[model samples]
Target: METEPSAALMSAIVTEHFVLQSGAGTTVSEALGRSSLYLSALSSSLIALGFAAQTPGLLLPFAAAALPTVFVLGVFTMVRLVGTGVQNMLYLSGISRIRGYYRTLDPEAARYFARWGAGDGETDDALGSLAVRGGPMAGLFTAASMIAVINGVLAGVGLALLTYYVVTDHHLPAALAVGLVAMTAGLAMFFRYQHRCYLRVQR
Candidate 1:
């Protein structure tokens, strides 16, 4: 017989899904910010390089670019390290909290909660077991971070070339600027849409 889930079952499923999605959203937002910063730094360095290369100095141009590049990469690495670390801990802690919550309810109700809670627990367990037997969250966050990194690299290179041309009194390149603007707008729209989807699911 086809049976409807109990109220407790519904609650458990919703809670688990909410937690996972919230975590994912946070991860995506963070990656977006980091990617934007990385790209901006790279763009600045390229602009500085173009300007410094015009001077009669020996080390200025290279130093200008190298210093910023080093700073960007360093920041990127540190952010990834910290963010992934927190995500890992949060995943485990959230699951633990969920399991504990289910422990106190009536047995029949608790059974439904237990089933969904098990799903929640398994989500964390699978991630935790990925590497170091506790690094799935870390790895997932790292992978997500790379998506932004890759986008930043492309955006940075494009903006740098555009800036170089602009400062040199060359006709401002319309195409690159247009492309960057389009990409930024698209990312914003995508995030907004995803957030709306999250809300609809929650409601």
Candidate 2:
């Protein structure tokens, strides 16, 4: 049987992990929001221009050709958003774990984590809120939710355009359905990617 680790070693490990968690959480969450904004802008521009590119007489073939490009770009953008989301989740998991250790060390400190107050009004804005209920982390997640919604809208538009093209040019109903599924997979991708992150934070 292996010997038990010393209390000092355990404490050192916890402190190191806590610092790592704080750094990663802050960095990745900001990166996720920034990237999401960039992709949202990119997709919006593409959508607007794709429609503008339509000619009065050549609408059908032009839009049909644009459908594939739109769908591919939409899927690619959404994949990056989902990947960034997963990294954010990892950061949240670290934060959750560190918060647990803090509470374990001193249950009374939980109140301070929610709000640090030394009777100074300045501390109100300076201290970060650790309350999982509608705190800064909540805002991070809300941003993610909004990003996902925008991505879903883009995917839906892609599906409609692709479906129109498939019906007009391919003459196949089954192909249209498959195209819908493939184009609208953004939400599916988000849920699948974030599921593990949710579980990690929960634990």
Candidate 3:
């Protein structure tokens, strides 16, 4: 014979559901905070670079020192944000499972949480509504993608400045070409990492 869930079991399930939801929200907030910190640092660096540019003999040295630092910071931020995204997805999945259990306890509970249930289709649709469309291109629209692109540009520009000032004899054309190549390579590397992260999430 079928029996109702014990009160203690129900209380535990409710607590787990609340914890998972809180975790998901915390991950999102953390991602935003980390991104903001990275951007604030980048902006301050750019402003300092602007000031350095006005002073003779300071621009090259300051840029040479600052650009690499900013790029490294960006790399760290991007990686952490990707991890946060993964954590949030896991939390959401747990919450969805709990909602499914709730529906099992009361058939009418499905109406209130119509989007999420034991059915994979309903869960996927609910998640899709919350995030971008899934595919190879989905990662490109994330905050991590934005940081990766900016870091790539910084790397390229840093290389170009070094080439023009130290390696080449101030050859603008050669430096430009080198910078473009570096930027392309950096972007490719970052995108590859993001793709791998996306694949993990898919699994």
C-alpha lDDT of all candidate models, in order: 0.51, 0.53, 0.82
For candidate 1, list the clashing residue pairs, or say none.
none
For candidate 1, the per-residue lDDT at 92 reads 48
lDDT of 2 by residue, 153-178 (tens): 65665555555565556545655565
Better of 1 and 3 by TM-score: 3
Deviation from native of the Cα of residue 3 in model 3, angstroms:
2.8
Q: Tens digits of per-residue lDDT for model 3 on 1-203? A: 66899999999999998998899889989989999998899899999999999999999888988888888999899899888877777787777777767777776887876653233643364356466556678778877888888888888888998898899989999899999999999889888888887677657
Error of 3 at 98 (Å): 1.3
> What would you estimate as the lDDT of candidate 1?
0.51
Best by TM-score: 3
- Candidate 1: list runs displaced more than 4 Å: 1-9, 58-73, 80-82, 85-203
Q: Which residue pairs overlap in candidate 2's backbone?
A: none
**Candidates by TM-score, descending order:** 3, 2, 1
Candidate 2: what lDDT? Answer: 0.53
Rank the models by lDDT, top first: 3, 2, 1
lDDT of 1 by residue, 1-203 (tens): 54665899868866895886577567657766766666576667667767777877733447545654655574454457446444644554565455545555555655654433223444444344333233223333443344444544444445544455544444455545654774576445433433343233222
Per-model RMSD to reference: 12.5, 8.8, 2.4
